[model samples]
Target: MTSGWVFEEAAIVFVSILAGIIFFYISSPSVKHEKKQQLEEGTSLIINFVLFIWAGKIVLNIHIFVTDPLAVLAYPSDAHAFYMAVLLLLVNIVYKATRKQMYVGTVLSALVPIFLGSAFLYEFIEAVWNDNTMSWSHMGLLFILLILFLIRYEQIRPFTMTALIFTIWSLGQTILTFILPYTTLYGYMMSLWFLILVFTISLIALIYNKRKVT
Candidate 1:
Protein backbone atom coordinates (compact mmCIF):
# COMPACT_ATOMS: atom_id res chain seq x y z
CA MET A 1 0.00 0.00 0.00
CA THR A 2 1.04 3.57 -0.61
CA SER A 3 2.17 5.69 2.32
CA GLY A 4 -0.82 8.00 1.76
CA TRP A 5 -3.25 5.06 2.01
CA VAL A 6 -1.62 3.86 5.21
CA PHE A 7 -1.89 7.33 6.69
CA GLU A 8 -5.57 7.51 5.82
CA GLU A 9 -6.31 4.18 7.44
CA ALA A 10 -4.43 5.16 10.58
CA ALA A 11 -6.24 8.48 10.70
CA ILE A 12 -9.61 6.77 10.41
CA VAL A 13 -8.77 4.41 13.26
CA PHE A 14 -7.49 7.20 15.50
CA VAL A 15 -10.47 9.48 14.93
CA SER A 16 -13.00 6.68 15.32
CA ILE A 17 -11.55 5.73 18.69
CA LEU A 18 -11.45 9.34 19.85
CA ALA A 19 -15.02 9.94 18.71
CA GLY A 20 -16.23 6.78 20.43
CA ILE A 21 -14.63 7.79 23.68
CA ILE A 22 -16.13 11.28 23.50
CA PHE A 23 -19.56 9.91 22.73
CA PHE A 24 -19.31 7.42 25.57
CA TYR A 25 -18.38 10.23 27.94
CA ILE A 26 -21.31 12.35 26.78
CA SER A 27 -23.71 9.45 27.26
CA SER A 28 -22.41 8.63 30.70
CA PRO A 29 -25.08 10.80 32.21
CA SER A 30 -27.68 8.65 30.56
CA VAL A 31 -26.32 5.53 32.17
CA LYS A 32 -27.94 4.57 35.46
CA HIS A 33 -24.84 3.83 37.47
CA GLU A 34 -22.24 5.33 39.71
CA LYS A 35 -19.28 7.24 38.29
CA LYS A 36 -16.85 4.59 39.46
CA GLN A 37 -18.86 1.84 37.85
CA GLN A 38 -19.05 3.74 34.59
CA LEU A 39 -15.30 4.29 34.54
CA GLU A 40 -14.64 0.60 35.21
CA GLU A 41 -17.07 -0.58 32.57
CA GLY A 42 -15.87 1.95 30.00
CA THR A 43 -12.26 0.95 30.57
CA SER A 44 -13.15 -2.72 30.19
CA LEU A 45 -15.07 -2.03 26.97
CA ILE A 46 -12.13 -0.08 25.48
CA ILE A 47 -9.70 -2.84 26.38
CA ASN A 48 -12.00 -5.47 24.91
CA PHE A 49 -12.34 -3.58 21.63
CA VAL A 50 -8.60 -2.93 21.37
CA LEU A 51 -7.82 -6.58 21.95
CA PHE A 52 -10.50 -7.63 19.50
CA ILE A 53 -8.97 -5.49 16.75
CA TRP A 54 -5.46 -6.68 17.55
CA ALA A 55 -6.61 -10.27 17.42
CA GLY A 56 -8.34 -9.71 14.10
CA LYS A 57 -5.21 -8.12 12.63
CA ILE A 58 -3.06 -11.00 13.85
CA VAL A 59 -5.48 -13.61 12.54
CA LEU A 60 -5.68 -12.04 9.12
CA ASN A 61 -1.90 -11.57 8.73
CA ILE A 62 -0.48 -14.51 10.60
CA HIS A 63 1.48 -15.83 7.63
CA ILE A 64 3.04 -12.47 6.90
CA PHE A 65 3.85 -11.97 10.56
CA VAL A 66 5.51 -15.38 10.83
CA THR A 67 7.90 -14.47 8.02
CA ASP A 68 8.43 -10.80 8.91
CA PRO A 69 7.48 -9.94 12.46
CA LEU A 70 7.85 -6.18 11.90
CA ALA A 71 5.95 -6.09 8.63
CA VAL A 72 2.50 -6.39 10.21
CA LEU A 73 2.40 -2.69 11.01
CA ALA A 74 3.04 -1.85 7.39
CA TYR A 75 -0.07 -3.68 6.32
CA PRO A 76 -3.21 -1.61 6.77
CA SER A 77 -6.38 -3.39 7.86
CA ASP A 78 -9.43 -3.35 5.61
CA ALA A 79 -13.15 -3.68 6.12
CA HIS A 80 -12.84 -7.43 6.66
CA ALA A 81 -10.64 -6.87 9.67
CA PHE A 82 -13.09 -4.32 11.06
CA TYR A 83 -15.98 -6.73 10.61
CA MET A 84 -14.03 -9.55 12.22
CA ALA A 85 -13.19 -7.37 15.20
CA VAL A 86 -16.83 -6.40 15.58
CA LEU A 87 -17.94 -10.02 15.36
CA LEU A 88 -15.45 -11.13 18.00
CA LEU A 89 -16.43 -8.31 20.33
CA LEU A 90 -20.09 -9.14 19.97
CA VAL A 91 -19.50 -12.83 20.60
CA ASN A 92 -17.43 -12.11 23.68
CA ILE A 93 -20.08 -9.81 25.07
CA VAL A 94 -22.85 -12.34 24.47
CA TYR A 95 -20.88 -15.16 26.04
CA LYS A 96 -19.88 -13.32 29.19
CA ALA A 97 -23.29 -11.74 29.72
CA THR A 98 -25.08 -15.06 29.31
CA ARG A 99 -22.63 -16.87 31.56
CA LYS A 100 -23.10 -14.27 34.26
CA GLN A 101 -26.87 -14.25 33.73
CA MET A 102 -26.79 -10.53 33.12
CA TYR A 103 -29.81 -8.86 31.57
CA VAL A 104 -29.28 -9.03 27.84
CA GLY A 105 -31.41 -6.05 26.92
CA THR A 106 -29.75 -3.85 29.49
CA VAL A 107 -26.30 -4.82 28.33
CA LEU A 108 -27.18 -4.14 24.72
CA SER A 109 -28.88 -0.88 25.57
CA ALA A 110 -25.77 0.36 27.27
CA LEU A 111 -23.53 -0.69 24.39
CA VAL A 112 -25.46 0.28 21.24
CA PRO A 113 -25.77 4.05 21.76
CA ILE A 114 -22.06 4.55 22.07
CA PHE A 115 -21.57 2.44 18.97
CA LEU A 116 -24.17 4.39 17.05
CA GLY A 117 -22.30 7.59 17.73
CA SER A 118 -18.95 6.08 16.82
CA ALA A 119 -20.29 4.55 13.62
CA PHE A 120 -21.80 7.84 12.57
CA LEU A 121 -18.57 9.70 13.19
CA TYR A 122 -16.51 7.09 11.34
CA GLU A 123 -18.75 7.24 8.29
CA PHE A 124 -18.78 11.02 8.32
CA ILE A 125 -15.02 11.17 8.45
CA GLU A 126 -14.74 8.60 5.69
CA ALA A 127 -17.10 10.54 3.47
CA VAL A 128 -15.11 13.77 3.81
CA TRP A 129 -11.76 12.07 3.47
CA ASN A 130 -12.79 10.22 0.33
CA ASP A 131 -14.55 13.24 -1.20
CA ASN A 132 -17.76 11.32 -1.79
CA THR A 133 -20.62 13.79 -2.09
CA MET A 134 -23.14 10.94 -2.08
CA SER A 135 -21.75 9.85 1.25
CA TRP A 136 -22.97 13.02 2.92
CA SER A 137 -26.52 11.87 2.31
CA HIS A 138 -25.64 8.58 3.93
CA MET A 139 -24.13 10.52 6.81
CA GLY A 140 -27.44 12.33 7.25
CA LEU A 141 -29.15 8.98 7.69
CA LEU A 142 -26.64 8.06 10.35
CA PHE A 143 -27.43 11.30 12.13
CA ILE A 144 -31.08 10.35 12.22
CA LEU A 145 -30.11 6.96 13.63
CA LEU A 146 -28.06 8.52 16.41
CA ILE A 147 -30.93 10.82 17.30
CA LEU A 148 -33.38 7.93 17.34
CA PHE A 149 -31.16 5.88 19.63
CA LEU A 150 -30.74 8.79 21.99
CA ILE A 151 -34.48 9.42 22.11
CA ARG A 152 -35.62 5.81 22.48
CA TYR A 153 -32.75 4.26 24.32
CA GLU A 154 -34.60 3.75 27.59
CA GLN A 155 -37.86 2.57 26.04
CA ILE A 156 -36.71 -0.18 23.69
CA ARG A 157 -34.96 -3.49 24.11
CA PRO A 158 -31.32 -3.26 23.02
CA PHE A 159 -31.42 -6.13 20.55
CA THR A 160 -34.62 -4.83 19.04
CA MET A 161 -33.19 -1.35 18.63
CA THR A 162 -29.99 -2.73 17.15
CA ALA A 163 -31.90 -4.88 14.65
CA LEU A 164 -34.04 -1.92 13.71
CA ILE A 165 -30.99 0.26 13.14
CA PHE A 166 -29.32 -2.37 10.97
CA THR A 167 -32.45 -2.83 8.93
CA ILE A 168 -32.88 0.90 8.43
CA TRP A 169 -29.27 1.41 7.41
CA SER A 170 -29.31 -1.49 4.98
CA LEU A 171 -32.63 -0.46 3.49
CA GLY A 172 -31.43 3.11 3.14
CA GLN A 173 -28.38 2.00 1.18
CA THR A 174 -30.48 -0.16 -1.07
CA ILE A 175 -32.58 2.88 -1.85
CA LEU A 176 -29.54 5.13 -2.24
CA THR A 177 -27.89 2.87 -4.80
CA PHE A 178 -30.90 3.29 -7.03
CA ILE A 179 -31.49 6.96 -6.31
CA LEU A 180 -27.87 7.95 -6.83
CA PRO A 181 -26.81 5.73 -9.69
CA TYR A 182 -23.91 7.87 -10.87
CA THR A 183 -21.78 7.61 -7.76
CA THR A 184 -18.92 5.16 -7.71
CA LEU A 185 -16.30 4.52 -5.07
CA TYR A 186 -13.41 3.00 -7.00
CA GLY A 187 -15.91 0.64 -8.64
CA TYR A 188 -15.91 -1.49 -5.50
CA MET A 189 -19.68 -1.06 -5.10
CA MET A 190 -19.19 -1.45 -1.37
CA SER A 191 -22.59 -0.03 -0.48
CA LEU A 192 -24.44 -2.15 -3.01
CA TRP A 193 -22.94 -5.41 -1.71
CA PHE A 194 -23.19 -4.41 1.94
CA LEU A 195 -26.84 -3.47 1.45
CA ILE A 196 -27.68 -6.87 0.05
CA LEU A 197 -26.01 -8.86 2.82
CA VAL A 198 -26.98 -6.65 5.76
CA PHE A 199 -30.59 -6.25 4.62
CA THR A 200 -31.06 -9.98 4.21
CA ILE A 201 -29.48 -10.94 7.50
CA SER A 202 -31.11 -8.17 9.48
CA LEU A 203 -34.54 -8.93 8.03
CA ILE A 204 -34.15 -12.60 8.89
CA ALA A 205 -33.01 -11.81 12.41
CA LEU A 206 -35.85 -9.35 12.93
CA ILE A 207 -38.37 -11.94 11.80
CA TYR A 208 -36.87 -14.67 13.96
CA ASN A 209 -36.75 -12.46 17.02
CA LYS A 210 -40.36 -11.47 16.59
CA ARG A 211 -41.46 -15.05 16.11
CA LYS A 212 -39.53 -16.20 19.15
CA VAL A 213 -41.07 -13.45 21.25
CA THR A 214 -44.57 -14.22 20.07
Candidate 2:
Protein backbone atom coordinates (compact mmCIF):
# COMPACT_ATOMS: atom_id res chain seq x y z
CA MET A 1 0.00 0.00 0.00
CA THR A 2 1.06 3.55 -0.66
CA SER A 3 1.98 5.97 2.10
CA GLY A 4 -1.19 8.00 1.41
CA TRP A 5 -3.46 5.02 2.10
CA VAL A 6 -1.65 4.25 5.34
CA PHE A 7 -1.88 7.89 6.38
CA GLU A 8 -5.64 7.99 5.81
CA GLU A 9 -6.19 4.81 7.77
CA ALA A 10 -4.12 6.18 10.64
CA ALA A 11 -5.97 9.47 10.44
CA ILE A 12 -9.36 7.80 10.69
CA VAL A 13 -8.26 5.76 13.68
CA PHE A 14 -6.80 8.84 15.36
CA VAL A 15 -9.94 10.84 14.69
CA SER A 16 -12.12 8.06 16.08
CA ILE A 17 -10.13 7.92 19.34
CA LEU A 18 -9.95 11.69 19.72
CA ALA A 19 -13.66 12.18 19.11
CA GLY A 20 -14.51 9.60 21.76
CA ILE A 21 -12.19 11.13 24.36
CA ILE A 22 -13.45 14.64 23.63
CA PHE A 23 -17.06 13.56 24.05
CA PHE A 24 -16.28 11.66 27.22
CA TYR A 25 -14.69 14.71 28.81
CA ILE A 26 -17.47 17.07 27.76
CA SER A 27 -20.58 15.18 28.91
CA SER A 28 -19.49 12.95 31.78
CA PRO A 29 -19.42 15.47 34.59
CA SER A 30 -20.10 12.84 37.23
CA VAL A 31 -16.62 11.55 36.71
CA LYS A 32 -15.14 14.93 35.97
CA HIS A 33 -13.13 14.72 39.16
CA GLU A 34 -11.49 11.52 37.91
CA LYS A 35 -10.44 13.07 34.65
CA LYS A 36 -6.95 11.65 34.80
CA GLN A 37 -8.17 8.18 35.61
CA GLN A 38 -10.83 8.36 32.94
CA LEU A 39 -8.34 9.60 30.40
CA GLU A 40 -6.01 6.77 31.27
CA GLU A 41 -8.79 4.22 30.98
CA GLY A 42 -9.90 5.61 27.66
CA THR A 43 -6.34 5.76 26.42
CA SER A 44 -5.73 2.21 27.49
CA LEU A 45 -8.88 1.02 25.81
CA ILE A 46 -8.05 2.83 22.58
CA ILE A 47 -4.54 1.50 22.58
CA ASN A 48 -5.70 -2.02 23.19
CA PHE A 49 -8.28 -1.72 20.47
CA VAL A 50 -5.71 -0.57 17.95
CA LEU A 51 -3.42 -3.34 19.02
CA PHE A 52 -6.21 -5.86 18.61
CA ILE A 53 -6.82 -4.55 15.14
CA TRP A 54 -3.19 -5.10 14.31
CA ALA A 55 -3.31 -8.53 15.87
CA GLY A 56 -6.37 -9.32 13.81
CA LYS A 57 -4.68 -8.11 10.68
CA ILE A 58 -1.62 -10.19 11.33
CA VAL A 59 -3.53 -13.34 12.18
CA LEU A 60 -5.70 -12.99 9.13
CA ASN A 61 -2.58 -12.64 7.03
CA ILE A 62 -0.28 -14.91 8.92
CA HIS A 63 1.30 -16.34 5.78
CA ILE A 64 2.32 -12.89 4.64
CA PHE A 65 3.48 -11.93 8.13
CA VAL A 66 5.51 -15.10 8.32
CA THR A 67 7.07 -14.34 4.98
CA ASP A 68 7.39 -10.58 5.24
CA PRO A 69 6.44 -8.89 8.50
CA LEU A 70 6.85 -5.38 7.15
CA ALA A 71 4.55 -6.09 4.23
CA VAL A 72 1.83 -7.34 6.56
CA LEU A 73 2.25 -4.27 8.67
CA ALA A 74 1.70 -2.12 5.62
CA TYR A 75 -1.70 -3.62 4.92
CA PRO A 76 -4.89 -2.06 6.28
CA SER A 77 -7.20 -4.06 8.49
CA ASP A 78 -10.58 -5.24 7.26
CA ALA A 79 -14.10 -5.78 8.66
CA HIS A 80 -13.07 -9.01 10.32
CA ALA A 81 -10.23 -7.24 12.09
CA PHE A 82 -12.67 -4.58 13.23
CA TYR A 83 -14.96 -7.23 14.70
CA MET A 84 -12.02 -8.90 16.40
CA ALA A 85 -11.01 -5.62 17.97
CA VAL A 86 -14.55 -5.10 19.28
CA LEU A 87 -14.81 -8.65 20.63
CA LEU A 88 -11.50 -8.33 22.45
CA LEU A 89 -12.43 -4.94 23.79
CA LEU A 90 -15.60 -6.38 25.28
CA VAL A 91 -13.66 -9.30 26.68
CA ASN A 92 -11.11 -6.95 28.18
CA ILE A 93 -13.79 -4.94 29.93
CA VAL A 94 -15.48 -8.02 31.32
CA TYR A 95 -12.19 -9.44 32.57
CA LYS A 96 -11.24 -6.22 34.30
CA ALA A 97 -14.66 -5.70 35.86
CA THR A 98 -14.78 -9.29 37.11
CA ARG A 99 -11.36 -8.87 38.67
CA LYS A 100 -12.50 -5.58 40.31
CA GLN A 101 -9.92 -3.60 38.42
CA MET A 102 -12.72 -1.69 36.71
CA TYR A 103 -16.14 -0.43 37.65
CA VAL A 104 -18.86 -1.17 35.12
CA GLY A 105 -21.04 1.86 35.78
CA THR A 106 -18.28 4.43 35.68
CA VAL A 107 -16.51 2.89 32.71
CA LEU A 108 -19.79 2.59 30.82
CA SER A 109 -20.72 6.21 31.28
CA ALA A 110 -17.41 7.19 29.76
CA LEU A 111 -17.65 4.42 27.17
CA VAL A 112 -21.07 5.44 25.88
CA PRO A 113 -20.10 8.99 25.01
CA ILE A 114 -16.78 7.88 23.56
CA PHE A 115 -18.52 5.31 21.41
CA LEU A 116 -21.11 7.73 20.14
CA GLY A 117 -18.61 10.51 19.61
CA SER A 118 -16.17 8.27 17.82
CA ALA A 119 -18.90 6.73 15.71
CA PHE A 120 -20.29 10.11 14.74
CA LEU A 121 -16.90 11.49 13.90
CA TYR A 122 -15.92 8.38 11.98
CA GLU A 123 -19.07 8.58 9.87
CA PHE A 124 -18.67 12.32 9.55
CA ILE A 125 -15.20 11.85 8.18
CA GLU A 126 -16.40 9.09 5.90
CA ALA A 127 -19.26 11.17 4.57
CA VAL A 128 -17.39 14.44 4.20
CA TRP A 129 -13.74 13.66 3.64
CA ASN A 130 -14.24 10.44 1.78
CA ASP A 131 -17.25 11.77 -0.16
CA ASN A 132 -19.28 8.74 0.73
CA THR A 133 -22.43 10.84 1.09
CA MET A 134 -24.46 7.71 1.70
CA SER A 135 -22.74 7.65 5.07
CA TRP A 136 -24.56 10.84 5.95
CA SER A 137 -27.52 8.71 6.93
CA HIS A 138 -25.30 7.05 9.51
CA MET A 139 -23.95 10.42 10.56
CA GLY A 140 -27.49 11.67 11.12
CA LEU A 141 -28.45 8.67 13.23
CA LEU A 142 -25.30 8.93 15.35
CA PHE A 143 -25.85 12.66 15.83
CA ILE A 144 -29.26 11.96 17.32
CA LEU A 145 -27.75 9.40 19.68
CA LEU A 146 -25.07 11.88 20.69
CA ILE A 147 -27.71 14.49 21.44
CA LEU A 148 -29.92 12.05 23.32
CA PHE A 149 -27.00 10.87 25.44
CA LEU A 150 -25.81 14.40 26.15
CA ILE A 151 -29.30 15.48 27.18
CA ARG A 152 -30.25 12.50 29.33
CA TYR A 153 -26.91 11.43 30.72
CA GLU A 154 -27.37 13.56 33.80
CA GLN A 155 -30.92 12.32 34.29
CA ILE A 156 -30.51 8.62 33.68
CA ARG A 157 -29.52 6.27 36.45
CA PRO A 158 -25.95 5.07 36.38
CA PHE A 159 -25.15 1.81 34.51
CA THR A 160 -28.30 2.08 32.38
CA MET A 161 -26.82 4.64 30.04
CA THR A 162 -24.91 2.16 27.89
CA ALA A 163 -27.91 -0.07 27.46
CA LEU A 164 -30.08 2.90 26.61
CA ILE A 165 -27.60 4.22 24.06
CA PHE A 166 -27.14 0.81 22.46
CA THR A 167 -30.87 0.16 22.28
CA ILE A 168 -31.61 3.52 20.70
CA TRP A 169 -28.70 3.26 18.30
CA SER A 170 -29.52 -0.24 17.15
CA LEU A 171 -33.21 0.54 16.78
CA GLY A 172 -32.45 3.64 14.76
CA GLN A 173 -30.00 1.86 12.52
CA THR A 174 -32.33 -1.08 12.01
CA ILE A 175 -34.96 1.35 10.81
CA LEU A 176 -32.49 3.22 8.67
CA THR A 177 -31.52 0.03 6.88
CA PHE A 178 -35.06 -0.27 5.58
CA ILE A 179 -34.96 3.22 4.07
CA LEU A 180 -31.36 3.57 3.03
CA PRO A 181 -29.26 1.61 0.59
CA TYR A 182 -27.18 0.28 3.44
CA THR A 183 -25.93 0.93 6.97
CA THR A 184 -22.62 0.25 8.63
CA LEU A 185 -21.32 -0.43 12.12
CA TYR A 186 -18.05 1.41 12.01
CA GLY A 187 -16.97 0.64 8.42
CA TYR A 188 -18.37 -2.86 8.42
CA MET A 189 -21.58 -3.72 6.61
CA MET A 190 -23.80 -5.44 9.15
CA SER A 191 -26.77 -7.70 8.61
CA LEU A 192 -30.36 -6.70 9.45
CA TRP A 193 -30.85 -9.66 11.76
CA PHE A 194 -27.72 -8.70 13.67
CA LEU A 195 -28.89 -5.14 14.09
CA ILE A 196 -32.32 -6.26 15.24
CA LEU A 197 -30.70 -8.73 17.61
CA VAL A 198 -28.54 -5.98 19.03
CA PHE A 199 -31.64 -3.85 19.60
CA THR A 200 -33.36 -6.74 21.32
CA ILE A 201 -30.38 -7.51 23.52
CA SER A 202 -29.82 -3.90 24.44
CA LEU A 203 -33.51 -3.47 25.21
CA ILE A 204 -33.42 -6.55 27.39
CA ALA A 205 -30.37 -5.29 29.23
CA LEU A 206 -31.96 -1.88 29.72
CA ILE A 207 -35.14 -3.42 31.11
CA TYR A 208 -33.30 -5.88 33.33
CA ASN A 209 -31.03 -3.19 34.73
CA LYS A 210 -33.85 -0.75 35.34
CA ARG A 211 -35.87 -3.45 37.07
CA LYS A 212 -32.93 -4.43 39.19
CA VAL A 213 -32.45 -0.87 40.33
CA THR A 214 -36.13 -0.20 40.95
Candidate 3:
Protein backbone atom coordinates (compact mmCIF):
# COMPACT_ATOMS: atom_id res chain seq x y z
CA MET A 1 0.00 0.00 0.00
CA THR A 2 1.03 3.58 -0.62
CA SER A 3 1.63 6.33 1.96
CA GLY A 4 -1.76 7.90 1.23
CA TRP A 5 -3.54 4.63 1.98
CA VAL A 6 -1.56 4.24 5.21
CA PHE A 7 -2.50 7.74 6.32
CA GLU A 8 -6.18 7.18 5.60
CA GLU A 9 -6.13 3.90 7.50
CA ALA A 10 -4.54 5.59 10.48
CA ALA A 11 -7.15 8.31 10.54
CA ILE A 12 -9.95 5.75 10.44
CA VAL A 13 -8.39 3.82 13.32
CA PHE A 14 -8.04 6.94 15.45
CA VAL A 15 -11.63 8.01 14.83
CA SER A 16 -12.87 4.53 15.66
CA ILE A 17 -10.93 4.47 18.93
CA LEU A 18 -12.21 7.90 19.94
CA ALA A 19 -15.80 6.89 19.22
CA GLY A 20 -15.47 3.67 21.21
CA ILE A 21 -14.00 5.48 24.20
CA ILE A 22 -16.83 8.00 24.23
CA PHE A 23 -19.46 5.27 23.97
CA PHE A 24 -17.92 3.20 26.75
CA TYR A 25 -17.69 6.14 29.13
CA ILE A 26 -21.24 7.30 28.49
CA SER A 27 -22.62 3.81 28.98
CA SER A 28 -20.75 3.17 32.22
CA PRO A 29 -22.83 2.55 35.40
CA SER A 30 -23.46 5.33 37.90
CA VAL A 31 -21.65 5.41 41.21
CA LYS A 32 -23.23 6.15 44.63
CA HIS A 33 -24.95 9.53 45.18
CA GLU A 34 -22.09 11.95 45.87
CA LYS A 35 -19.68 10.04 43.69
CA LYS A 36 -22.28 10.04 40.96
CA GLN A 37 -22.43 13.82 41.08
CA GLN A 38 -18.67 14.09 40.70
CA LEU A 39 -18.71 11.56 37.88
CA GLU A 40 -21.45 13.48 36.12
CA GLU A 41 -19.55 16.73 36.31
CA GLY A 42 -16.31 15.12 35.17
CA THR A 43 -18.13 13.36 32.36
CA SER A 44 -19.57 16.63 31.18
CA LEU A 45 -16.11 18.14 31.02
CA ILE A 46 -14.83 15.15 29.07
CA ILE A 47 -17.76 15.37 26.67
CA ASN A 48 -17.17 19.03 25.98
CA PHE A 49 -13.47 18.47 25.49
CA VAL A 50 -14.24 15.64 23.07
CA LEU A 51 -16.68 17.84 21.20
CA PHE A 52 -14.02 20.49 20.76
CA ILE A 53 -11.62 17.88 19.42
CA TRP A 54 -14.29 16.50 17.12
CA ALA A 55 -15.04 19.94 15.73
CA GLY A 56 -11.38 20.54 14.99
CA LYS A 57 -11.11 17.09 13.41
CA ILE A 58 -14.17 17.69 11.26
CA VAL A 59 -12.70 20.88 9.88
CA LEU A 60 -9.34 19.25 9.24
CA ASN A 61 -10.95 16.18 7.66
CA ILE A 62 -12.98 18.38 5.33
CA HIS A 63 -9.85 20.17 4.24
CA ILE A 64 -8.11 16.83 3.74
CA PHE A 65 -10.90 15.31 1.67
CA VAL A 66 -11.22 18.36 -0.58
CA THR A 67 -7.56 19.26 -0.81
CA ASP A 68 -4.80 16.73 -0.13
CA PRO A 69 -4.40 13.97 2.44
CA LEU A 70 -1.26 15.81 3.54
CA ALA A 71 -3.32 18.89 4.31
CA VAL A 72 -4.45 17.30 7.59
CA LEU A 73 -0.85 17.05 8.68
CA ALA A 74 -0.30 20.73 7.96
CA TYR A 75 -2.25 21.78 11.03
CA PRO A 76 -1.30 20.28 14.39
CA SER A 77 -4.50 20.49 16.42
CA ASP A 78 -4.02 16.82 17.31
CA ALA A 79 -1.81 17.87 20.21
CA HIS A 80 -4.71 19.71 21.81
CA ALA A 81 -6.99 16.70 21.34
CA PHE A 82 -4.44 14.39 22.92
CA TYR A 83 -3.91 16.76 25.80
CA MET A 84 -7.63 16.94 26.57
CA ALA A 85 -7.99 13.17 26.35
CA VAL A 86 -5.22 12.70 28.89
CA LEU A 87 -6.78 15.25 31.18
CA LEU A 88 -10.16 13.50 31.02
CA LEU A 89 -8.57 10.17 31.80
CA LEU A 90 -6.69 11.65 34.73
CA VAL A 91 -9.83 13.29 36.10
CA ASN A 92 -11.69 9.99 35.97
CA ILE A 93 -8.91 8.24 37.81
CA VAL A 94 -8.55 10.95 40.42
CA TYR A 95 -12.29 11.15 41.08
CA LYS A 96 -12.44 7.42 41.63
CA ALA A 97 -9.46 7.47 43.97
CA THR A 98 -10.54 10.46 46.03
CA ARG A 99 -14.35 10.19 46.06
CA LYS A 100 -14.47 9.79 49.84
CA GLN A 101 -12.58 13.02 50.44
CA MET A 102 -14.90 15.85 51.50
CA TYR A 103 -12.79 18.69 50.21
CA VAL A 104 -12.68 17.39 46.66
CA GLY A 105 -13.71 20.68 45.20
CA THR A 106 -11.07 22.60 47.07
CA VAL A 107 -8.42 20.07 46.13
CA LEU A 108 -9.52 20.07 42.51
CA SER A 109 -9.61 23.85 42.42
CA ALA A 110 -6.04 24.09 43.62
CA LEU A 111 -4.75 21.38 41.29
CA VAL A 112 -6.63 22.27 38.11
CA PRO A 113 -4.95 25.62 37.72
CA ILE A 114 -1.53 24.10 38.11
CA PHE A 115 -2.30 21.38 35.60
CA LEU A 116 -3.98 23.64 33.05
CA GLY A 117 -1.43 26.39 33.51
CA SER A 118 1.33 23.96 32.68
CA ALA A 119 -0.52 22.82 29.58
CA PHE A 120 -1.00 26.43 28.48
CA LEU A 121 2.65 27.20 29.03
CA TYR A 122 3.69 24.10 27.11
CA GLU A 123 1.47 25.13 24.18
CA PHE A 124 2.92 28.59 24.30
CA ILE A 125 6.42 27.15 24.04
CA GLU A 126 5.36 24.93 21.15
CA ALA A 127 3.86 27.88 19.32
CA VAL A 128 7.09 29.81 19.72
CA TRP A 129 9.55 27.01 18.98
CA ASN A 130 7.52 25.36 16.25
CA ASP A 131 6.58 28.62 14.55
CA ASN A 132 2.85 28.00 14.83
CA THR A 133 0.35 30.77 14.08
CA MET A 134 -2.48 31.84 16.37
CA SER A 135 -6.04 30.64 15.81
CA TRP A 136 -7.96 33.48 17.39
CA SER A 137 -11.43 32.36 16.23
CA HIS A 138 -10.99 28.85 17.60
CA MET A 139 -9.63 30.17 20.89
CA GLY A 140 -12.57 32.57 21.17
CA LEU A 141 -15.05 29.75 20.70
CA LEU A 142 -13.22 27.68 23.34
CA PHE A 143 -13.36 30.59 25.78
CA ILE A 144 -17.12 30.91 25.33
CA LEU A 145 -17.63 27.19 25.84
CA LEU A 146 -15.51 27.23 29.03
CA ILE A 147 -17.62 30.12 30.37
CA LEU A 148 -20.76 28.12 29.71
CA PHE A 149 -19.26 25.16 31.55
CA LEU A 150 -18.43 27.31 34.58
CA ILE A 151 -21.99 28.62 34.63
CA ARG A 152 -23.36 25.12 34.40
CA TYR A 153 -21.04 23.73 37.08
CA GLU A 154 -21.62 26.61 39.55
CA GLN A 155 -18.00 26.54 40.77
CA ILE A 156 -17.03 30.08 41.74
CA ARG A 157 -13.97 30.76 43.92
CA PRO A 158 -11.48 28.81 41.83
CA PHE A 159 -12.96 30.34 38.71
CA THR A 160 -12.39 33.81 40.15
CA MET A 161 -8.72 33.07 40.74
CA THR A 162 -8.38 31.72 37.19
CA ALA A 163 -10.03 34.84 35.80
CA LEU A 164 -7.77 37.34 37.52
CA ILE A 165 -4.63 35.52 36.41
CA PHE A 166 -5.92 35.22 32.85
CA THR A 167 -6.87 38.91 32.69
CA ILE A 168 -3.36 39.96 33.59
CA TRP A 169 -1.86 37.48 31.13
CA SER A 170 -4.10 38.74 28.35
CA LEU A 171 -3.23 42.38 29.06
CA GLY A 172 0.47 41.56 29.00
CA GLN A 173 0.05 39.71 25.71
CA THR A 174 -1.75 42.69 24.18
CA ILE A 175 1.16 44.91 25.13
CA LEU A 176 3.69 42.40 23.75
CA THR A 177 1.82 42.20 20.45
CA PHE A 178 2.54 45.89 19.78
CA ILE A 179 6.18 45.61 20.69
CA LEU A 180 7.10 42.19 19.23
CA PRO A 181 5.15 41.89 15.94
CA TYR A 182 5.99 38.16 15.81
CA THR A 183 3.67 35.25 14.98
CA THR A 184 4.53 33.57 18.28
CA LEU A 185 3.58 36.72 20.16
CA TYR A 186 0.29 36.81 18.26
CA GLY A 187 -0.41 33.21 19.25
CA TYR A 188 0.44 34.03 22.86
CA MET A 189 -2.07 36.85 22.77
CA MET A 190 -4.78 34.49 21.54
CA SER A 191 -4.00 31.95 24.26
CA LEU A 192 -3.90 34.72 26.87
CA TRP A 193 -7.37 35.93 25.82
CA PHE A 194 -8.76 32.43 26.10
CA LEU A 195 -7.15 32.02 29.53
CA ILE A 196 -8.72 35.30 30.69
CA LEU A 197 -12.09 34.15 29.43
CA VAL A 198 -11.71 30.91 31.38
CA PHE A 199 -10.88 32.93 34.46
CA THR A 200 -13.96 35.09 33.97
CA ILE A 201 -16.14 32.01 33.77
CA SER A 202 -14.56 30.77 36.97
CA LEU A 203 -15.56 34.02 38.65
CA ILE A 204 -19.17 33.49 37.61
CA ALA A 205 -19.04 29.98 38.97
CA LEU A 206 -17.67 31.31 42.27
CA ILE A 207 -20.56 33.75 42.60
CA TYR A 208 -23.15 31.08 41.90
CA ASN A 209 -21.56 28.69 44.37
CA LYS A 210 -21.45 31.39 47.06
CA ARG A 211 -25.16 32.10 46.60
CA LYS A 212 -25.98 28.40 46.89
CA VAL A 213 -23.89 27.98 50.05
CA THR A 214 -25.37 31.01 51.77
* Top lDDT model: 2
Tens-place lDDT per residue, model 2, 160-192, is 888888898888899888998888866777678
lDDT (Cα, tens digit) per residue for candidate 3, span 1-214: 4556545434543443344334323433334464455445544554555465545555547756466745554444454444444455556546755776334453344333332333343334344554444524233333443344335334345444444444444444454445444312212223434445545655565666567768
lDDT of candidates 1 onward, in order: 0.66, 0.82, 0.44
- Alpha-carbon runs more than 4 Å astray in model 3: 1-54, 60-63, 66-70, 78-112, 115-156, 183-214
lDDT of 3 at 169: 44
User: How many clashing pairs does model 2 include?
Assistant: 0
- Runs in model 1 deviating more than 4 A are 1-8, 24-46, 176-197, 208-214
Which candidate number would show the highest TM-score if scored against the true structure?
2
Residues 56-114, candidate 1: write the lDDT tens digits: 77789999888895677566665556567767776877787879844455455545655
Score residue 7 of candidate 1 by CA lDDT.
75
Clashes of 3: 8
Clashing pairs in 3: 155-205, 156-205, 156-206, 157-206, 159-202, 159-203, 162-199, 163-199
For each candidate in turn, the TM-score is 0.72, 0.89, 0.36
